[model samples]
Target chain A: MSRQALAELFSRCRAENRAALLPYMTAGLPDPEGSVRLFVAMAEAGADGFEVGIPYADPLMDGPVIQAAGDRALAAGSGVEVALDILEQVVAETGRPSVVMTYVNPVLRMGPEVFAQRLSQAGASGAIIADLPVDEALPFASALDRHGMGLVLFVAPTTTEARLENVVQASPPFVYGVAELGVTGERDMASSHIGSLVARVRKHSEVPVVAGVGIATPDQARSAAAAADGVIVGSALVRRVMEADTVDAAEDALRVAVGELADAIRRD
Target chain B: MRLDRPDNQGRFAEYGGQFAPETLMPALEELETEFAKAWDDPGFHNELNKLLADFVGRPTPVYRAERLSDQLGIDLYLKREDLAHTGAHKINNTMGQALLTKRMGKNRVIAETGAGQHGVATATACALLGQECVVYMGEKDIERQALNVQRMRMLGTEVRPVTSGAGTLKDAVSAAMRDWVATVDTTHYIIGSVVGPHPFPWMVRELQKVIGEELQEQMDGSQRPHPDVIVACVGGGSNAMGIFYPYVGSDVRLVGVEAAGYGLETGEHGASLVAGSPGVIHGSMTYLLQDVQGQILEAHSISAGLDYPGVGPEHAYFKDRQLVEYTSITDEEAVEAVNLLASVEGIIPALETAHALAWIAKEADSLRGQTVALNLSGRGDKDVQQIIDLVDADE
Candidate 1:
């Protein structure tokens, strides 16, 4: 059911002639209620899909903003179950396709089979696990597939053309193309390297390839959407929530920001 | 044992693999290919062996500690790795990896350090090989190992202090991994211990096998050729694996001593193999000191080098297969062992090595009739200040 939901989401994006507006949300960022509240606002403001981050203890790939958000989430006593609960609540409210983003350790600790089962039960369309390269990702991918959830894989700027097939062969819902060379953070338009990486990924896979890691503003999102099927904005959205004074302020800020991104990604 | 492990997928019975970001997957592949080519090449071996012998001072003797032996009523043989260049067994791996960095055509080297011995050795090797070197150390480790920090700086290497997640060895490893994720194209991360992603645990162990290999050659002339037992400290288990890998299936019993900081009950120790459960850390699945939610716990020890939450994957394999007996010693006991070795033989052992000596000292009476070989992995000159403070506190 969840895998079908994800496929339907991509179909919807194509029919609407707009790139998927997948806004990354860190679950339980100051608190669980606030995280859900903000996601509800993002969904209302035209977020086509959601990437829900389950805060981890050590987020090596994440920059300072997402790292701080995760740190606060963990400090508030949120674990895998709590994050899954948040996912359930978001899906219930939004009724939109959403994927859980996590580092591999938490899923491994939860036991991959049980982890996949729980996420599927929580109504997660798929999962994006950071730090799990395709070399060691087969078992986890199979586990998710067995549970009827899409497994998202990454194709970084550093990934060469020769190595593109193995990742594409996995047939992820979307190939997460890391636009930048460094950890996840905001970057300027001075370096727009997403197109080349997206082009390389498209050579092997027909599925929509979404560029992430370096994108921030609506302008960057539109420019990135021009090169790829979609864009995943993480640190930029996270910084807004982290720097906000109250829940209302954060929700309003996210609603406006996601709305701008959605407008910018509209191809027609 | 036959000792062919990590398989092709880099797993040692479900432990160890490329648990890194996609950015470094190609880099790991490149490294594995280059490392295999270098391993099979005689020219690579010729250069590395020459550097090991002349630059890093290899083939350090196995000195029989007569006085300590008399006290223990056992023939105690110390593999004097303290005599090696840079005052620890770390130089062996550093020289080999530095050469690999050159062989791979990467001119930059990045590493993480705890006691800073590996940092100093890496800096020295990079200086010799004309490779730019950078070392990530925990903020707390930088404070404790001040002398080693200065030594790294003096060797013309940049020592970056990591402040995240308890500011210790585990954090330093994460910081270095993050750096490698960004700059992997021109940079070859020289992981200090046998604890990182695949090829590392295998590569480091292969490079360091000289310790056990030399012991095999040196003890051949003795009446009891192979010692009844071999002991080495297990901070990430490089030194222990170095000496133990050769004797995996041999009659010689292998024991790895870990640092049990305040004690197991206090929940403050670096005894990952002894007290930890299996989890992923620093790009490899291994025994880790992590909470139920897989959040890494802060590991404590007076010895900065041993203050880590994860052990090498091979050590985890040995633990599961019952190939080696893993034990722990408290900081107080390790300090006493340091004083004991300095007083008995006038040899100051590093706090990391003292953990092994402390274990051997405690078990000496039980193994009275046998020969025990302990890898004295490092000297204590770098730890003199902390020792003085500890002794003064005792007085």
Candidate 2:
């Protein structure tokens, strides 16, 4: 999808009074087929967007749930290429918007230009390279722009205003505001300074700002949606998949969580 | 003068090369120019020498190991690097680099530590210079060397325990490198040894040459023209290179001993030179103990200082060029050497440096009438309690 397409999608989510349900799933967790089916199922179950995680040996900013999923995916011999292929199949099946979530090394290894081109060809809407800072985002951003793909940047609570402005200016689509200092997990969102963070980011950028990182419960998602244009829940969806008794159970649980979160955010 | 030669490709004897990310190319180039100019400036050398003597307590004695030499049937002269302040030859490089950081107008220093010797040395320099210091140590190392961690903290250094990937020295170095790349504007990564991309190995060597320089001066003054052999342990090979570089042109045969935790054949060892193949690791071309698929393997050694999977690039170059003969000493042998030195010489050498002394003891009979000088790299006070525990366990 083009940057314009992603922007329109974000605007539509805002207009419809619904928080964006961005479900995250490791590429080959459970198995490759199960991962693809889960992706399609989540999309069909009303996920506005999906974050397809590429397994790596070291996931610095990930908690135990995501880390274990990544470990299982890696043990199944899944890598960036595998993740992209699975994403291609999911998009082909459901025509849902998706973002590739990965670290910088794999992208660097794949060559930024080629990676962007492949993602664009495979119908991936955008990407969020977790480790790439705003100061070093130009090359990757330019590559994504070259392929008509969006580069989503993360704005943490600790991020300085100057850095946030730089990230907003460099990145396309929208800025993802990390609501807390810790990694992704089903964290207690009551203490998250989500409102002020979204307000600060809104003051600096004309681009849409979505808040993530600990929006676990439907109540938390609704609360986050009240202050931001979008609420991206990842760790909760990943946790559901991990705790599922079977692949079908995982898909069913993810659909139920997304439907409930989407309904809760839309209600108000 | 062929002053531009070493800078041609960031090399020291065709081993050290700038195998770093393109982002660091500019910084490496800048460091190379500054270090080159600093090396020729007599003022810089004089100031460094003064600090080494007054502050760091240099010209650390050359004691004759009379009892051990008599027992082994050879004359052993110990170049006492252990007497240096902060307890290891690591300080020689840190102090020089810290001063260079000041000269370059940088106020923050970052360093990576394995056994925390370098952390202590860097912390000492930062405290002395009043510069803000940050040290990255693996969580495992922080636990193993808690006292050294506390020592670093006492010296006012911020010690960050890295919990990434195996959480060892290699990962710590990786984290430090990442930090340097991100914060290169005000930070000078005082790489703890003769490693890293470029200019670092050469710069560290230039600083550590004091070891060999003093040994030469002291040896000449004592009527011993030169040693028949010079021995030192190799971890990242800083101490060994520090004592061997000045004697390169001389006929003194250099012997580098590595940690053979169990034995070389058991594959449970840190004898990188003997068991490793030349591969690119941590930015420089070096001998690394990697598996069949090129994954860097975890090293095992009783001596924390000697427990690295890769040796310095300079040591790789030396080994390949046949300038130094590499050997291994078992943990059992090193422990015995520590006990022997404490009993005979009344000096306890660091577990790391004891590897060299152990090798010398084992090979002393072959060099019967020859005078061999060993780099007593650090005091064993840090390892005393650990040794006591090991002894008690053995009993």
Who wins the TM-score comparison?
A: 1
The candidate that achieves the highest lDDT relative to the unseen native structure:
1
- How far in Å is the alpha carbon of A84 misplaced in model 2? 12
- Candidate 2 Cα RMSD after full superposition onto the native fold (Å): 7.4
Query: lDDT of model 2 at residue B3?
Result: 23
lDDT of 2 by residue, B1-395 (tens): 11223546666655667655333445676788888898889999898889899998988999888888888888889998888999999999998899889988999999999888999999999999999999999888887777899999999999999876666777678778767755666888999988877788888888887899888888884576468899999988899989998877567889999999999888988888999886656766688886532445678888878888888888887787787899999999999999999999899889999999999889877889898999999988878767777879989
Q: Itemize residue pairs with steric clashes in candidate 1.
A: none
Poorly placed runs, candidate 1 (over 4 Å): B223-225, B391-395
Q: Model 2: iRMSD?
A: 8.4
Across B1-395, the per-residue lDDT of candidate 1 in tens digits comes to 42565789888877888888899888988888888899999999999998888877789988999899999899999999999999999999999999999878899999999999999999999999889999999999998889999999999999999988788888888888889888998999999889888879989998899999999998875644568899999999899999999889877899999999999889999999999999888889999998887777889999999999999999998899899999999999999999999999999999999999999989888989788999999999989998887778889
Q: Could you give the interface RMSD of candidate 1 in angstroms?
A: 1.1
Estimate the Cα RMSD of every predicted model relative to the unseen true structure: 1.6, 7.4
Per-residue lDDT of candidate 1, residues A178-243 (tens digit): 888878888876236777877787676678888888788888888888777777898999999998
Worst 10-residue lDDT window for candidate 1 chain B reads B218-227
Grade the docking of candidate 1. Answer: medium
How much is the lDDT of residue B218 in candidate 1?
A: 84
